[model samples]
Target: MVREKNPNVLSVHSIIHRQALTAKTLPTKLTTQVFNLLAYLLDICYSLNLLNLNLQDGGSNTIYHRDAITTYTYKFQLWNRKIIACNYSCFPKLFGMLEEALIKQTDTTNKISNQLQHLTDEIKRYFPSLCYNDSYRLAMDPFTLTQMFYRKHCKTIAVIKTKYRSKFNIASGLRSALSSTQPRIENLCKNVQAHPSH
Candidate 1:
């Protein structure tokens, strides 16, 4: 009711639900892997429904059947790249696992591999600071990578500024701001300071 009263208010729904709706309405010209993946998800839903029906018919013990169903559901979720437990810090690792699974399902010189690479590139484009260094997953602090890369990019811009000092007021200005921010970032990530060259 409050949302109705306020035009600016909007309803936010679960991402999984949104994805499911979009998947259903995807154009028929989708690639082979995407088509198969959607079909596989539909099959999983059907199997789950069958499990529920069988349980209701008293075909077996409720606890054991439910446990088996839960296990299968988890496997399906992982297979579908829709893990509920995944968070921002763990996203790169999850993508790596999904890519590995995709690799197993198709050859390197296939459309599926190209699609996977495109998906990875898109993710990296959005989160370059976090996804740039795949080997830096020690802890779940995304800020560490963010600050480290921010400092690095600042230095890079500063170097470019030095090459064209007369026409580079913006880069010079950014370098000055970064100079003040770097120390605080260094203090926040002593581990990065220990291996700053990385």
Candidate 2:
């Protein structure tokens, strides 16, 4: 209805919410393995919770939101690679569970790796902005530009400082520039009597 009233208004869905929903589609078999996959789910849920907090705290800064998303996407890729290589360090709970239960890492590693890949794929599919470098470059340019601007004006600032320092009576110049009272030229002239020889 809001959009109907104002056609130019844009609507957006929460990216974290979308990710949480996508995570719900994990296979029943995958969920059933390794003590109902509690350890795995707990790790994923904890990460997501942290991500949600980051996104929530980002407030109205789209740059911060983009950064958070980009960081999370990179982490997903890293986790996928680590899982494929049989390294479960990133998911400490899952690693501990496997070690304690004498479970072969091969059994669940493939499933988890596949799910991570799927999640990464889904994120790319949904957030195409992450694929473009131009947006990030533009977002980052302001700080760079500000530094460049200050560097370019440094000589001018130095010249101004030197000119100000060379002045003999800076306070008088400032008083002339800032004073509000007008000079009483006529009164001063009237007070001066004509010269006796004139």
The C-alpha TM-scores of every prediction are 0.22, 0.52
Residue 3 local lDDT, model 2: 82
Candidate 1 lDDT over 144-195, as tens digits, reads 7677777778666666677668773565566665565545665667656354
Clashes of each: 0, 0
Give the alpha carbon lDDT tens digit for every residue of 92-153 in model 2.
88888777766565767888988888888888887787636655765768677657655866
lDDT of 2 at 157: 53
Error of 2 at 26 (Å): 22
lDDT of 1: 0.51
lDDT of 2 at 62: 74
The deviation in Å at residue 124 for candidate 2 is 0.6
Q: Given candidate 2, what's the lDDT at residue 21?
A: 81
**In model 1, which runs have C-alpha deviations exceeding 4 angstroms?**
1-34, 77-198
Clashes of 1: 0
lDDT for residue 108 in candidate 2, whole number 0-100: 79
